[model samples]
Target: MRIPANRMPTAAAYRPDSRDAGIRRYFGLVQFALIVGVPASRLCSWRHGTHIWVPSPDIQVGDHPGWSMACIDAWVPGGDPFLRPPVVQFADTAAIRARYHGMPASTLWACIGDGTIPRPVVWVDNRPGWLL
Candidate 1:
């Protein structure tokens, strides 16, 4: 399921639109936190150094892993991903992963880790670590 940012706070907040009770059984707070936390933290790397890591503001929601790209290039003026940290809105990534814990990691990784897709570049500003 593709949960757009406008519909949810983060990818973690999404739940599958399935009737299967098993699909709904595994969701929990901890899993949701990890799903949101991993990418959010990765995107925040600009505060420490030059692009330690950064995921796009958009994230794929569901049991399946999906890749993301930034809305704007980091080098463009006022386009830095670090400068614009994704908001911790309602039902974000933390919630989505929790809802779809049963999905296979292989599938998830395949969608998100595909080497063929082009990703936005994330530039780091190390002058002030943790400032952002």
Candidate 2:
């Protein structure tokens, strides 16, 4: 039987029974980085620090092992922030320009780049697209 997407078990629920178990559920650094909204470099830094260490799984992927999503969830519990709708008012470059009455997009981007205006909370198609 096929399980519904929403009702499917989380990766943690499928933890292996033994150290030599053939099956494993884990998230690689890239996957974890995407989930956390930070760059992979930052995630690596966290791993290097004493506070965070990605959990090692019994089953390895290639030569490197990955962390169980369940453990990561326990370490940092929260829904994916990126998927959530913006909590504050936001506008795209065009909207922002219109709102500012002919302010150029380049100027707005420069301001955002230099931390003059708030940095974008969301990215759209590789472009900053939010206001705070």
lDDT for each of the candidates?
0.32, 0.52
Give the candidate number with the greatest TM-score. Answer: 2
Tens digits of per-residue lDDT for model 2, 44-131: 7766675555433323333333554454554552332222222233365666667667788789878778987776554322334454
Q: For model 1, where is the 10-residue window of minimal lDDT?
A: 123-132
Tens-digit lDDT track for model 1 on 59-93?
A: 22222222222222222322434554452222323
User: Which ten contiguous residues of candidate 2 have the minimum total lDDT?
Assistant: 77-86
Candidate 2 achieves a global lDDT of: 0.52
Report the C-alpha displacement of residue 81, candidate 2, in angstroms. Answer: 22
Error of 2 at 77 (Å): 9.4
Q: Which regions of candidate 1 are displaced past 4 Å?
A: 1-33, 36-43, 46-49, 59-132
Model 2: lDDT of residue 130:
50
Question: Which residue ranges in model 2 land beyond 4 Å of their true spot?
Answer: 1-23, 51-59, 77-132
Can you give the TM-score per candidate against the true fold? Answer: 0.17, 0.33
**Which lDDT value does model 1 have at 120?**
20
